[model samples]
Target chain A: MKNGRDPVIVGLADSALEGGRFVKQASVLGHCALVANEALKEAGLSMKDVDGLLTAGMWGVPGPGQLNTVTLGEYLGIMPMFVDGTNIGGSAFEAHVAHAAMALREGYCEVALIVYGSDQKSLRSRTLGGRPSVLNMQHETPYGMLTPVGGYAMAARRHMHEYGTKSEHLAEIAVAARKWAQLNPAATRQDDMSIDDVMDSMMISDPLHLLDCCLVTDGAGAIVMTTAERAKDLKTTPVSVKGYGESHSHWAISEMPDLAHLLPAAKAAKRAMEMAGVKHSDIDVTQIYDSFTITVLLSLEALGFCKPGEGGAFVSDGRIAPGGEFALNTSGGGLSALHPGMFGMFLLIEATRQLRGDCGARQVKGAETALVHGTGGTLSSGATVILQKGLQA
Target chain B: MSYDNPLPVIDQDSAPYWEAARQGRLDIPLCADCGKHHFYPRTVCPHCFSDKLSFDTVSGRGTVHSFTISRRPAGPGFADEVPYVVALIDLQEGPRMMSRIETDDVESVQIGSSVEVIFVRATDEVTFPYFKLT
Candidate 1:
């Protein structure tokens, strides 16, 4: 490690997942404790040894889910010195990692545990509707824009209009994700799918087919972070957190500054890569949040992998597929793996696993550097983190 | 057909915007300092920190920046209106707003097409400013 103060992820684990469903059915907090204990165990530490806690979920707001860290800490019986219960949407965990890095670097906490759990599929709590028609949502819900999906669809349509992108380009992303998922035993949708399959799939929103969306499943993930010196003595090889940045532009999709251009992602990625002192070419693998196919495309462009309006071409010709030049969403991504509700936590887990060479068939060969970006709240929030194998002196 | 759609929940800051819609007018908050317009009404100027803001009527004209056809209804309230067109309108006044684009053929709605706001009284308390192709 370069410095004793450098923050590195020492442990990562997800709850018992079978066909993308939580095998050990438990409450949100129960799953939280389950994944937390597993991840801590991987780090050769227990919850009692943790001094910091970070968590987020869509369990039950205005109720138990309120003050998530307090509820989780109480459930896990750990009173921490640092706590963050930021609920920015699916990408909250990525933001948490960014915050945890700062805390670990500053010695605010000795051991930081970030956890997320959701039972949206098991409970069938996932809704195809928009948010409540109140406050900022009032302007959107009344018009019946199928939240999340509709926002992404509108962006896809605009992207096509501006850059001559095709639905086929978007389909290639879904097809590619499925190919990766087929190799992942934990992936929920491992069935073979082609571009035509995505095109023929039912349309949830125009310009976005059912296959273009991510899977809805029940899952939970947790990660443990500490200073490089402490992580060096942990159970597993630590993946150093080289750089990270988080930002949000809007809550309502209508408020997005630019549909064609993901400004927040560009800003976050620029800062993270700049801090890591790496260029786009130096990134060996990328695990971007795929809330929608368009999200991956837009994120690739914003992350500097390709030029804006060039994402359509960047992802074409199966370049991002298994045998392709670029390795993206190797854990199958949210598109084909599992999207319980918030998927940012899983991105971190998979990115860490890849860097540790824990993945079997789906591993990117000699992957030393990985870029993980998460898009939450209908492209309203973007968080980018840069990770690398082996600590730098 | 009977009106069975979700209605906007008006709040204090957005009361005037809805009131203007009820009067068949498209009113939005205009920042006196930045001279910029914002939508879905807010207390502070989004572009500038100045609280010097006032309501002004826009041309009710915009171009469709982007749109999507919801093959599935957004919620139970919109169950009867599947395949609806929700669009982001780039208002002539330079601000963007989200509203449904009503047309006989939903597929005909294209980006860059001109649209004008048309107020639809959902109830005594709610008047939605939907758009129609011009």
Candidate 2:
């Protein structure tokens, strides 16, 4: 049974590896625990202080033999009064923050923990992008259609056909992210990347060069949240959760309603910015999830940073790079930094890091407010969160 | 290693559509209530969500809404078909479906290209509705 708990923001921590290097043969639960313990330590509290637990679950349908919330709770050795196994693919963790915030505000539980870890690259596991199965594969799978790149390519192709967005427009996003990566030591790729280098890379899918795709690195990220009052008494400065919102339009790429429009982020970002009482220009820094180059472009357009078809032009010629107006993806994002399958958790961790002034070299200067957006399920789901440096009255 | 291509599983609502594809015809769900057509043949009308639906044969003509040239195979099953073209086909009857665009050269297919559907039997389990430039 559980009792009273306060609403506050306290600790934030990621896994041991800040970048692409990962522990081979590592279990998922081990990754989850490692980060949760690190977060608990950072909060100046022990595991016993955590009365509530929420984790981004395995991205799939739950059946007889799947990882359920109760199973994960038991694995973590925490008997929480409240639990959520909401799996919205990459955007799951951002949604978890909103859920955790509600739980904390309503006094469901205090000291809640959200964690995500994936061992895709090291183990070469097929948790995703595996051979089709009866229950797992979509109808389009039999037609030589598999992998997320194909679906994302379809959207990019549509955006090109409709808006005349060139591959160079997409290339700029990859360039900016790689430039950010160069400043961060922990980032996976260390090459001096350029837009030409991006264009020179092999085409994985038409219009989307190899550079446009994200690395399948194995990693984990976690964050702890308590009430603002409780957070103030803690060790490190609490990164206040100003506002968050999440929404999804469809599950598959083929069913995205319109290829040119990214409605999930449009709707979710609107709700989040409304709740935060901040306009587009007020955002000091943004950690837009860069699962793919087009993902960032579509997100920017959908979130109203640019007009509908002007995302390409907006990122042109050193716009979103290191000293660009947006100060976007300061952690190099999933592109040049790390992408361990579910990337929503990493966005929160990065946003919190920027707000805390903990990000050393690649940190945005005097970064007060940061917006994190995560797109999931082949541009199907979108989640947004705004984190501020100091607590607001 | 006896490998097999991943085939589409026939479900309750989509069973009739796949069966029709096996017979070299493109049948889509048409809702009598809304008087509109929908793709990926389902039990309920996507427009009105009405159960009053039936599979009807169509002209199988559509224009390419968008497309991609997969320089790499999508998965293990598509390894042989590298550099394939997949397109989102806007049906003449007013619905869109995802299918492969069969072309000798990728340059021939683009947005708004007139395409017609043709059933290409992948395996005994299922036949796919492939589109080709008209």
Candidate 3:
């Protein structure tokens, strides 16, 4: 039984996605500086205040080993007490948040700066070389089952087969996300769209339309975490790390025992809630990773937000839409918002903003407790973090 | 770009499975120590981590655990084969295999539905296994 830790999100920052300002190259280290500088500015601190640095592996750069954590730390001129470069797919950012929280609780470091950035869209093509690994690439890629969209499409197909989930049910999730994006000025997809329109759009993978998939954008996001006691003296309100949990079912979708159920996410969510000592009803907002529409539905069901296989029905009732009972993805999520490869940092930043009542038009009413879920590697791994407005040291 | 002549590279780890596929037989490694079967063709059993393993031919009969219809082409070479079905078939012999689902209508394929193995020769060097509704 792990108790709660008081790691506060003292600073949050992200570079502009429009006009290609901060990110024009494929270097992960360059984007790290952009996001880290913004976060320091927001905290009224400098790079000298950071003692720890964590980064995700750069995908856009060529060669096997281009960007790593130690190299990133050396370039940033910050000699930290701890350094991490754990890549568990896109959810690496959420894992970094959990790592920072645990390090703070154990008194490993005073301030941990977690950063993730990518130029996948501008520099690298979406297509990747097929490497034979026992986990994902070897199992399904041989028969033309490559790419994340295909992997997620396979999961969506299984859900439809078991529960009779229609394409419209999946489209409703996209519709809701686009609606939220319309309210956000920074959202990439601001155009209004209907469920039918989403269904009629270009089909990338059967059961998953183009709208169902997330955008691949060149962007970067960063967050600075400190102990709860030190957070009080910071510039912004501290959103305490109430609870967190993580689990991995397998490394690939083929190794997943059951496609209709997300066991790891369910187990992680249950443990997170138990540690936070809060129920589903206590959560005023949620920021689930929306790499695909099916991901949100599966995560919603796995997190106990709704009954199993009822995730398709839950979103259809407009519950997760803007101005609905429960606010979700106020930043428009990865679907409509900018997807910077490892987009989990954006989820944490949005959750912190929502809990602090900073989302002017997309804010949830009186949000006290919030939940954020991050899924990585074809739903193979997941991490859940719970946040609250105030906490006692 | 001409989307043709995509070759399957064989490494030491997957050489056995590829050789078996060329012989028109589906093979999986069964560990004698742990008495368990595993997929993706590994030298050591994932359960007990023992290298003492033997290859065995299965009945090639199983049920569809789950499947997905890929609307997008897998790569430049597979652009013509869009809207193909990829499935995870649970073999009766205890190992699950990942293969393409060969059925006219993907809608009719149900979970736990019966299926059997069929091999297709993709190139001279490699032959792949596929599953079809029985």
Candidate 2: segments with Cα more than 4 A from true spot: A1-8, A23-25, A57-65, A126-137, B1-3
The TM-scores of all predictions, comma-separated, are 0.98, 0.95, 0.92
lDDT, residue A332, model 3? 87
Where does candidate 1 chain B have its weakest 10-residue lDDT segment? Answer: B1-10
Estimate candidate 1's RMSD in Å: 1.2
Error of 2 at A339 (Å): 0.6
Give the chain A TM-score for each candidate.
Answer: 0.99, 0.93, 0.94
User: Which of the two candidates, 2 or 3, achieves a greater lDDT against the reference?
Assistant: 2
* TM-score of predicted structure 2: 0.95
Models ranked on lDDT? 1, 2, 3
- DockQ-better candidate, 2 vs 3: 2
lDDT of 2 by residue, A181-251 (tens): 88877788868888889999998877788899888887877788888767766787877777889998876
| DockQ in order | 0.88, 0.61, 0.49
* Root-mean-square deviation (CA) per prediction: 1.2, 3.0, 2.9
- Identify the runs in model 1 with alpha carbons over 4 angstroms from their true place: B1-3
Model 2 chain A: weakest 10-residue lDDT segment is A1-10
Model 1, B1-134: lDDT tens per residue?
45676777889999999999999999999999999999879989988878899999999999999999999888777877777899999999999999989898998999999999998888887889999999
